[model samples]
Target: MSDINNWVLPEGIEELLPDEALRLEKIRRDLIDLFASWGYQFVIPPLIEFLDSLLAGTNSELALQTFKLTDQISGKTLGIRADMTPQIARMAAHHIKKCDAPVRLSYLGTVLHARGAQIEKSRSPIQLGAELYGSQHIKSDVEIIQLMLEVLAVSAIQHVHLDLGHVGVYRGLAQQAGLTTSQEGELLDVLQRKSSDEVVELLETYKLDKKWVNVFVQLLQLNGDVTVLEQAKKVLKLGDASVQQAIEELQEIAALLQQSYPSLPLYFDLAELRCYRYQTGVVFAAFVPGFGSEIARGGRYDNLMIEQGEQVRSATGFSADLKVLTRLMAVILDEQAKEIILAPDVLDENLQGLIRELRTAGKTVIMQLPDSSKQPNHTALIAKVNDKWSVS
Candidate 1:
């Protein structure tokens, strides 16, 4: 027997009802306005595009997560966007490539991934973010990080724990060790899983530079408070200039952020290269007390534009799922839901004028229909009292 609930949605797909949708929309507007205040122009990329354009220069893994179909008009493959960053990158490099100064762009839209990023996450997430292009200074990094902190503040996310890492620390060491791409990939995978034994096994199997191998092992233990930088310097004593420089960069960022947010909880994880493949430099993730997964994460990916055959420029940004934040808002917020004011179905000019005035003042006024049962719960009813209309 077929259990036919025709309205049932596919797994991981969802529809927002009136209250949830209203709250989500309000957050979106507030965030976009915040971005604008920071001088970031908003851009809307199409929901779908040609496959090549969609996945160009991104991690090969993204292809599997993308939904594909044959286009009838051009007989070419089209993809529903799994991520909007690539499209925004394309716009920055091609359509708006001529800007002399760094381009700061923000976006908010629905992205359909083939599967959820985590076990019970949404397949279609409202991706909200800002991207900065054309500057490589530590100032650029600090700006994006500060902006991200501000975003969390605006969303009312409390007790945020920030985890910071830099891929350049590992990349430079890998270069010095002369490890091949496959070897680097394997090591990155082991580090991401934080498996100490596997890392040792791989290091012994490769028999790479003794100094670099020791440093690699030390990375796993390098975590916690700003003091971790000092420990990193000692642990990576044999580290090359690039490694030293990466540490210094992290120190500067930490100092600036700490100075700004004295009470902010900050952690440093040297082996925290979760998105090592796509991220070229500094990477970060934000977590609250109860959430097992990161609420938001992003980092520097300067080479993305180069892959698209455009001049390489510095770029960094962060994105959070609006749906998740909305959930959090619901938990912490007690917003008073507005009620509709019932207006009688009278053709009197003064009654109609009064309803118009209330609506213009941002009140919700619903005209009572002929059927009383169809009327909404009346918070206030407009009645004809004497010659003027009054609320009863």
Candidate 2:
């Protein structure tokens, strides 16, 4: 038999104590309020759902992270949601299928992952994000990015570095080069890790055009300030229209963000594909000083609704781990201060009436019991003074 005294929590699982839990709740509420102010409505998706529905469309990455189990009643596989984006996408597809363009939805929930995504990170994370459905316009992308920046700002995280990229650049090149799906996946893996020699070797193995291969090399090299955009335009001049259009969109969005937030530093990494599988177009991430990973990440995924058999809508959004943000902010959990009044044990009508008055006035009054030995820590004491009940 296992030793009962040797208590231990499962790895990657954690419990939040009172103060920490309260602080996290406060941050969650504040962020949701902020989302509401920006016209994003909140929705809570089920913590567990049908595996197929939960991991639908280009979500292999998410599927791997999800914890799956056979449902006792239905015998169907159910997965504890590893990512809430798909659930929100389904809702947008089925519930608001006929709604207007640009349906803004926000969600705050705990998503359970099979394993921690990073070292020292929780297996369960408080995911807070807003998604924009419909409208493929670049302005929509800009809006989501700006909202992400605002979220970080509201959390009191500063010195943010925004790294921007467009997956379309690479995806377009692969399509134009006629690389098979297997080949493309391998190349993407190489590119993500930035293995330059491997990328060269893989491209050469397929005998792709040397010019396009050079463009791939440039893709790896195109990481720096806004000047890299000019470099990309110059080096990838022979890219397809899709690639060109992607570059133009990045240029416009970067320029707009620079003009809007002159102080916020922006870096362009043409090869920075955070969510290459599902994310189709412009992708971005926000990082603060001293944090090794991105504080928040999001990009355009317009095909999600269409893949779920809903009307075609262009969408883009970002999500951040609220727990990470709260920690990074160094939030000091504070208990709500209440004016607690300790009342006398005597049940005289006058004393009761005085207690009632205090209670009615939003004061917390603790009436003492005659036989009780317990005492309450309070801000004030109610006692009879000069034949009148008064607080001292």
Candidate 3:
């Protein structure tokens, strides 16, 4: 007998069944092709990186999730990537050239990590996304958002909401609060989680002004309708060059995107904001039902090029968690039911030929079709053609 202990797979990891696997494969093909249609080039970055490279002042929450160990050859701390954005930024900075202007990239692959789940989720996830580098135009931001929606539209995920924010908004608010960096970070964490009480406590503890405090609390509750932008000025008074200017940025992006995705919902949350130090402009999180975490997330980072010492430019992008997308919406996926070509009484040559032809054409072809004779209720589309060939 096989030793069960030796054969057991690790917890939180899963095997994709044939049907599930095929569905995911189709999802990938569809999305990659969709991205290609928009001139976004395919890029499969290596899944591992020197730990220091990825953690270079990135979100501490993200750094904690990495599956870490020392590299055997380099003797350096190497780790599985928890996020791909930093590497994408690095790749753009290193190669891709100065004149490319807007370098568009797309990728679909597994990202391994430990403690992969966020506050409520408890499973490691497979993430897929695309990035737009260079070009700091607000149009680039709207374009990426439209593309994300298009992917969902094609995939038949109808109810999608993009909760957009300006990273600078809260970061600016943090500056105005006059709290130390550590206090600001803790307050940001509370806001991100939507814990209003924690946010209120922080505002009081920091002794922020009443008007600013009111705006801070309202920012946490910023959600629903583009009309919120119109009301923002009354609620949150701009502090000359700080948080107020950041609010203006979000409102500007909202107006630009609303013309295209007019029904697109907009929101503001001062509490749940972070200075993705690299993210210089608008940031966003995409939510869809069934997936416990953000389905897709990205933002504009105009400083990465300058950070690497280049002429200033801007870009924005997003990554859709293809694994979660396929799994959660399996029922709606066109490929949910396993389809088999129902051919019968055909010679082995013809069957093999058909299978090979379809397989080569990139269709997931099942060798054997369902047999109603053997099972009595098998449902499959049987090819209805006589052996004699006729010219039409």
Candidate 4:
């Protein structure tokens, strides 16, 4: 029972065995190469930082996700970065300050959040994403989406969907509802969970225009294939300039992506609000089979430049969640686990170098069987005996 409090893995935490760990590392490397080819250099923000600094402009919900503590030397509150987006923002506004416009940076690191994250999420999960600075053109939006799709395809992730959204759409709706900020937050909470009863109760709290209420409820339900957009266009009713503008953006971006990647699936969700506070515009999340959350997510943020003390310059980009991608690959590998094994059964210096050379050249060589009696974890699988070598 002493094991109960020895700082071991708590429930919902996962420890990757060698095979799974190796596979995850390989997937991370492949994604890095994918981003590198597109000219995205890498940057790794520190895992721990002064809590207030890391949360410069983030929302409360995000702030609560952090795991905090006090630094011994400074006695100031510190926390693990909940996400890399804000840190990347800091970097653009500071470290890479000298770079030219449209700076493209990618990163691969584990982000630590509160332990109460969604059941499947590891409090520590590897994130692979990018931040594109200094451009807000529609072409930039289209390119970021295109890059996300390309990474997924190159990662061998098929049978997926890219659901797009605009926080602008929701902001306009909430404003039209004439509800207080708290009321709007309630409204968003209901829609975020897709709870019709809760949404109806909250809608009743405000004497909202019945027409707008119906349209709002309908938008929450509006999620599906290309046909959903047709239904959305009907309820949207040409009233919300923001919503209409967002739709036009979607159409333009979708057209560009389809021109280049006709096979890529694309659609929209007007009520989808993942990172509501941090993203200033056009947001998209990619979901592949067998993964719970988005495999990739990013959006535009022009206002961030103003906050960064730089003149507002629209920017947009996306990142593939390496943790999710790794999990999906593990599921795929488990379904096809059979693999060839190899060994050079001599316990000598020269033989060891040969084995090392084989591995360095990308050969999967296992030194021994798992059940071997003499030094089960020994480097080589078997030893020379009578001028020959054998495994037990």
Query: What TM-score would every model get versus the actual structure?
Result: 0.95, 0.89, 0.80, 0.83
Q: Model 2 segments beyond 4 Å from truth?
A: 1-6, 330-384, 387-392
Ranking by lDDT: 2, 1, 4, 3
Query: Every model's Cα RMSD, please?
Result: 1.9, 3.0, 4.5, 4.2
Model 3 spans > 4 angstroms off: 5-7, 118-124, 193-197, 207-215, 267-270, 274-278, 289-292, 303-313, 330-392
Clashes of 2: 0
Summarize candidate 1's per-residue lDDT along 204-314 as a digit string, tens digits: 899887777777888899999999999998888676899889999999999999899889889999988888888889999888987889888889998888877778567
What lDDT tens digits, residue by residue, belong to model 2 across residues 1-392? 98987778878888888767767777888898999999999999999988887888756677789999999999999999988898898887875667765689999999998888887888988899999888888999999999999998888787899999999898988888888999988888888888788889988998988887877877899999988888888788777899889999999999899888998898999898868888889999998888889999999998887777877667789999988888877546445565778997886898999889989997889977788788867889988989998999
lDDT of all predictions, in order shown? 0.86, 0.86, 0.68, 0.73
Candidate 4 structure quality by residue, lDDT tens digits, 280-303: 788898887666778888898767
Q: Candidate 2 at residue 390, lDDT?
A: 90
> What local lDDT does model 3 show for residue 10?
63
Strongest candidate by TM-score? 1
Error of 1 at 175 (Å): 1.4
lDDT of 3 by residue, 1-392 (tens): 88888977566666778767877788788888999999988877788888877665466677777888988999999878877776776777765575565788877777766764654443456666777877666678888888887877666665677787777767766676676888766776777777667778877887788776766678777665666655655565654475567677677777787788777655554344554555777788777765566776777877655554445456578876666677666355445443444445546665566657756876554334345345222235335358532111
Q: Number of clashing pairs, model 3?
A: 6
lDDT of 1: 0.86
Name the candidate, 2 or 4, with the larger TM-score value. Answer: 2
